[model samples]
Target: MSRIQFDSVTKRYEADILAVDNFNLDIHDGEFLTLVGPSGSGKSTLLRMLAGLEEITEGEIRIGDTPVNRLPPRKRDIAMVFQNYALYPHLSVRDNMAFGLKRSTDLPAEEINERVREAAELMGIEELLDQKPKHLSGGQRQRVATGRAIVRDPAVFLFDEPLSNLDAKLRKHMRTELQRLQQTFETTTIYVTHDQEEAMTMSDRIAILDTGTLQQVGSPREVYNRPKNTFVAQFIGSPSMNMFVSKLDRSGDRPRFVGDIDLPISERQAESIAARSDADQFLLGVRPEHIHVHETSVEESVRAFVDIIEPLGSNDLLYFELESNIDVTSVIGNSIDIGEDEQGDEEEYKVFIEPESIPQRYENSDDPVYLTFDTEYVHVFDPETGENLSLDQRSTPEAQTESATGAGD
Candidate 1:
């Protein structure tokens, strides 16, 4: 298996459109990395560039130490499994698995057959070896395609949304199966998908993309719990994180985020924000799970009208909007300064609150409700840059020591 490198890689189309914009990343040897983002986010384009299906407009890509920007797909020693399975309708599973090895190498018939058999066994499709693609189920066909890649023993494995065509239950099963297979083979794998769940569950590290630019690349824990920017924070979570422009105010010893939404800052949080230049005016982010909604008032709780209640069996999602409905369209679309839009009276800021902390009286009620959340869980971002301010707070030795001491006490 090889460690891949993308050094300032870029792709452009005829109309001066940038499909991928100077992407630079390193995929470690035998690591399972997933490229994930929304539609038209350049994830598939990036994958295709690596697989040699498309040309890089500029820069270089390397497998291990060898630059492969000019290499053909066959010479790259990369095996790809596509979303459609791409199995031959006429060829049996055994032949499909052996085709690449036969054509690419001088392996004898006996060795080729043995390799195919081993691949089928590993994929749990040993019994279906002789069946043609027409006779095989979607999941079975996917297995055969994977088996074909496996027998080749390529330097890297590329998967392009291979589970997109499967049913939900089957997709879940295949996700686990694929993880197990990667673990067994210890092959460097790069998977591209629009599904965040697949990326979160399968990848050792996930690379998040948006509009052709890389947003963040980190482990699931780091990406989900400690996002670097507004996009990462919103995109990585379920129902997404609530983002709103808030005004920061200081009154004597205390500080608070006020205007449409309200959140009080503690001494530690205030100290953290005090270290920043644009801390007084920035975007405020809080996940649904971090919000505590209530019918009864609590300290640091602010009132809002309940917009909706979505029940998710074990838990509930309570959505609320500010009474004033401050418009943050530009702030949400791009990381811009949140100025008071005199005509934005129609826009209401929305926040998702988990109902576990709410009283049953406010279950499905549309009445005014109160919300209380920890200041530690609140993430503050620059109004114009969208960069997380709390990350700076966490990076310092003083902050780390203080946080560690607080946790211990």
Candidate 2:
């Protein structure tokens, strides 16, 4: 497998529209990287550029040490698996797998047969070798397509939402299988998918794209725990992180979070928040698991009304409406027996906000909710720029340490 690099890549379809922005990334050799984003985010366009299927409007794309901007698709030594299993309907699985090799090289019939058999065995589709694509199930047909790529042993494998055609259960199963195949082959893989769950589970590192620009590129935990901006924070989580607008004001000698509820900020946190010159108002971001029903009074707390409770088998998700009209959710243990609504009556339940749960401030709002966060976990961002002030500080040493630790762990 080879390393791929996109140096300031840009794709403009027309005078007014730009499909991909100035994208720059270094995909390591033999690494499994996923390009994840919503549709029209230019993930597919980027993949096509790498595959030599589309022209690069600007910048350079290199495969291994060679610049492939002028090279045809055949010279790129890459195999692509599309969303639709693009197999000849009349050809059997074995024939489909061998077709590429038959056209590319003048291998003897015996050699082609051996290679096809090996690929089929690797993909666990040996039993379906003689079956035509029309007769095989969706999963089986997908395996056949994968087998086609495997036989060629391309330097890079490009997957364009290959699992989108499968049912949910089948898709999950194939995700594991695909990871295993990549590991066994050690081929540099670039997978494009809109499914966040797929990106989170399969990729060694995820590259999040939005509006043709790279939003964030990191391991799943890094992006989820320490988002680079408001967009990344909101996009990465399931229930989504809760954000509230508040004002930063000084009460006597110390800085305090003044809003629907007033709470004192620690000296360290206050200094850090004050360091950002662009921050006039502050936005608070908290995850569902971090907020809980406060049993005792702490330094920071918010009085909120419980709106709805969703009981998951392992945990319960509590949704609350704050005084600012912003909705926040907390995940509580299912073992705790909070009485359910007998007559479907919604009551005002007091939820607690831990001091550590408060996120960094961005801008002030008229109606605000009182919030607090663990100073260490708080993420600060610039409202106008939509850039994370804490990302560079938190991403460098912490990110490297995390990578090493995760490898061992």
Candidate 3:
């Protein structure tokens, strides 16, 4: 395994279109780094560049200490697993896995058999060694493809949506298998997938790409909890964070988040907001799990009309619409006893947002939902620039603090 580096990498297909723009990253040795983004996000192009399947239009890509810009795929010492199984239908699984080694070297027949047997065992496909690709199941075929890569013992492993074709159940099972395999092999791996869950669950660190630009690169928790901008915030979450426009106002010593509903801020947060000249228009972001429904009175709470309720067994998802027409979703635990008998009927529900839950408030409208967040859980972003304003570009401290506070709360 080796450390991979991309320095100011840019890939342009045409003069006007840029597939990857100024991409720079350092992937640690033996790390499983996942490149996650929607379609047309340049993840595939970036992987192809690393595999030597595509030319680098500009900048450099280094594997270990060697520059591999001019090296061919085979010479780069990298193994790539494509989305399709890409197995030879005529060859048996054992022969398929041995194809690369046989072509590259005239190793003894005994050594080739030993290597292929080891790879099949590692991938738990030893039972299907004699079967051809056409006779194998989808999962078995996938393992055959992986076994082919494993036998190479390359410096780096590259995967491009390797699980996209599997059924949901099988995909989940393979996810666990892949994670375990990575740990066992300890090979430097770069995986590209549009599935956010795959990226979150499988990667040691995730790099989010959008519109040919690297938006955020950090651990899964760091990117999810403290996204660098509104786009990252919305893209990373499943139910997506709730956002609204509100203005910041100073009421005495503390800055108050004034909207359709009014909420007070902490002294430190107030001071922070007060010092910022650009704090006038900030977006308020809160996760679905952070919004709570309280039967009892709270110091800071907003009155919202419950629009719909979706019972999801272990948890109930409550959807509410504020007077401003902004919809907010809250996930209440299954143990919570709420009046579900009045389902499908509009009713007034008391929504309590902790002060920390409220991120920087925007000043676009007065009729804003008074959104409060656990100060530790809040994420502040610039509405105009779409950049995070809470902490530095790296979100270590903020993410740790938020997670600890969230667990305790």
Candidate number with greatest lDDT = 1
Tens digit per residue, CA lDDT, model 1, 1-409: 3999888888999999988888888888999999988788899998899999999999899998999999999889999999898998889888899989998999999999998998899999999998888998899989999999999999999999999999999999999999999999899999999888899999998888877878778777767877767767767766677766787787766777886568777667766666774444667787777777767778777777776566676777766776674555644435332222235332433445454555555534666788777667778877667667777655545434322211100
- TM-score: the better of candidates 2 and 3: 2
- Report lDDT (CA) for all predictions: 0.78, 0.73, 0.73
Q: Is candidate 1 or candidate 3 better by TM-score?
A: 1
What range of 10 consecutive residues in model 1 has the weakest lDDT sum?
A: 400-409
Decoy 2 TM-score against native: 0.83
Query: What digit string (tens of lDDT, one per residue) describes model 2 on residues 1-409?
Result: 3999888899999775888988888889999999988778899999999999999999999999999999999889999899997999888888899988988888999999999999999889999998889998898989999889889999999999999999999999999999999999899999999888899899998888877877778888888887766667766766566555555786569777665335566676666667764466555555666555543445677755445455554555555666653222122122211112234222222233343232322112233334345545555555555555555555678675544312200
**Cα misplacement distance, residue 49 of candidate 1 (Å):** 0.9
| lDDT of candidate 3 over 1-409, digit per residue (tens) | 3999888898998667889988888888999999998788899999999999999999999999899999998888888888997999889998999998988778998999999999999899999999889998888889999999989888899999999999999999999998998899899999999988899999988888887878777788888887766656766766566665556776577676666345566677656654553646565666677766553446677655545455555565555666653221222222221112224221233233343232222212333333334555556555555655664434567565433312100
Query: Once all C-alphas are superposed, what RMSD does model 3 give against the true structure?
Result: 9.4
Query: What global local distance difference test value does model 2 have?
Result: 0.73
Clashing residue pairs, candidate 1? 325-347, 325-348
Point out the worst 10-residue segment of candidate 2 by lDDT. Answer: 329-338
Candidate 3, residue 398: CA error in Å?
A: 10
